[model samples]
Target: MDNTRLPLLSTETPLRADAVRNRARLLEAAARLSAEHGAAAITMESVAAAAGVGKGTVSRRFGDRNGLLQALLDHAEQGFQASFLSGPPPLGPGADPAARLRAFGPALLHHQRANRDLYLAAEPAPDRRFLVPAGRLRHTHVAVLVRAILPDADADLLAHTLLSSVDVVLVDHLLRGHGMSLDRVEAGWHDLVDRLLP
Candidate 1:
């Protein structure tokens, strides 16, 4: 994957410093509400009330409830993206491709678990799911790693398979409904990578 050629997902213009701070404050309020109650509990009025800001401020910041949810998800995703894209060691650029790939699943699992409610609330529709910018970026990253590790393999398809194995909804089901531990889930990822590489 050509990193330089990767398309930016955002089109919004830069915000002024105060606007940035205000946006962060509102998102923090929304996150608190999400943590306290649930994603469903987040509303423009609710966030405004929680942040001690007017409804108009929330509306002006995020446009609507869905927009707010997307922004919140984006906020949660930024750190994860940065870690794998530019941060150090096994999950980042400095590691060998195989090591990086192995680290990706548990990292993703932790990320999704930390932001489970927000991710669930912002889950895109079936038709639009793969079209989401973050998802596409992940696919590209994984595919690049796959190609590096197994040059002859069907990297694109294999990347999809690898990613699907740790997808948040399935991980949630395995954790909540089937009573699987996170350690077990992470072990599954390691095993999957081992099998693929061996």
Candidate 2:
């Protein structure tokens, strides 16, 4: 995938230093609230109370609850995106395509696990699920790698299959309902990748 396809960070837009600090403070407050209580517990009022800011401030920052949730998701996903996009080898650029493909699953699993609540809470409706920017970015990345690894395969479909195997909802089911370990799920990813190899 083209590097241009990656999601832009909120910080990309210029802001006064105090505006930047205020945004971070608001996001941090929301994150803390989400972690401690639940995503359902996060309201502009709650975040404002937590951040010691007024309700108008929260509204001005995010507009509404949905906007706040999306911004928070973007905030959280950016780090993971950066790691895979530009960080060191394996998950990043330096490793061979095959190794990078192998690394992607575990990295994604950990990222999702760490942000499980945010993902589950922000889970889009069925129709819009795959259309989200972050999801699209992942699909493009995997499809590009799949094209490199399996020249004759349906790279787009294969990428979807690989991603679905570790999807947040499924992973939660495997871990919570089925009593599967993260390591086991990660191993399953490796096995799936290996089986796809020529």
Candidate 3:
């Protein structure tokens, strides 16, 4: 499937059959609507109609728009995690932690940009509110390498700094205004990470 972000649903356990179906319908509808009209155009009623299900089903499954966005974010996060943990060599498990952390940002930006509507709609009230878990995942993933290299610098801070180097605002600005190419962005990130990590 051409998923921008993969399933970030709860991994606590399996969901009920009906819930599973409803959830699937919701995602399909959200993806389609977000693509056509952008994230703002996707309403509960609209999603329900598109899914061929009841509005109540969508509301019950996701609570409200914010809740639905959160669920979608979770799914995307889970998909990202699952892929990195096992998908491929550079993006997955086989690369150096520091190197991998540097690589992840551009991929994430591209991923987010592709699903612009869903991403914009799902942005948290404050970045800290939603980015915490995602940050945690990236921080720890890089911390492993930090400990191996510096071992003296605070790994947590190092991770945070490394991550901040790829802020979307900066990326967007660089790309749109400065006419920076993706390869340049990726190369810049490489330089940024190398300097930040040490």
Candidate 4:
């Protein structure tokens, strides 16, 4: 993937140094609350109390509960994005497209599993689903890889299909509802990729 061509996933305006620190502090507090109690425990008031800030500050930083949750999810996604976009080896830029594509599914599954609660909580409405910056980035990365590996394929649609196979909601359902192991889910990803390759 050409890092230069990637979209800026964050829509927020740049903040001053202290404002950036304050936002990070708030997100950290929210994450701690989620870790300790669960996503439901992370309200504006709760985060405010945890971060030793007033409720108004939380409100100003993140418009509402949903916005706060989205911001928190974005915060968590940054590391995963960095890993695939610029970090070393198979998941990153140095490896072949096929290898990167193969590595993406398990990495995504693990990431979603790690932050399942926040993702589930912040799941966007169906109409606006694909508009999320993180989702767009994932799709773009996958499409780029697919286009490279299968030059004649419809990379855009193929990318969506591939991503849909490992979507967090579906994976969560398979895990919690149907009693599937994470290994099985990951194996399924490898199988899908194997079948797709020549």
The better candidate by TM-score, 1 or 4, is 1
Q: Which of the numbered candidates is closest to the native, going by highest TM-score?
A: 1
lDDT of 1 by residue, 17-65 (tens): 6789999999989888886787888999999999999999999999999
RMSD after Cα superposition, model 2? 7.5
Count of backbone clashes, every candidate in sequence: 0, 0, 3, 0
TM-scores for the candidates: 0.83, 0.81, 0.72, 0.81
> Ten residues in a row with the worst lDDT in model 3?
4-13
Give lDDT per model, in order.
0.91, 0.91, 0.71, 0.92
Instruction: Give the per-residue lDDT of model 3 (tens digit) for 1-198.
Output: 757444544442366666787797788778778767877777889889999988998998998987876776676667777776677857777887666666676777666655665555554566564366775776787677667667788887876776666655566678777998878877877787678676
For residues 149-195, write the lDDT of model 4, one tens digit per residue.
99999999999999999999999999999999999999999999999
lDDT of 3 at 73: 66
Off by over 4 Å in 1: 1-15, 35-37
Which ranges in model 3 have alpha carbons more than 4 Å from their true place?
1-15, 115-131, 149-154, 172-183, 194-198
Give candidate 2 misplaced runs (Cα > 4 Å): 1-17, 32-46, 49-56
Could you give candidate 2's per-residue lDDT for residues 1-198 as a string of tens digits? 676745454455555567779989999899888877878888999999999999999998899998998888898789889988888989999998899999999999988886788899888999999999999999999998999999999999999999999999999999999999999999999999999998
Worst 10 residues of 4 by lDDT: 5-14
Model 1 TM-score, all chains together = 0.83
Off by over 4 Å in 4: 1-15, 52-56
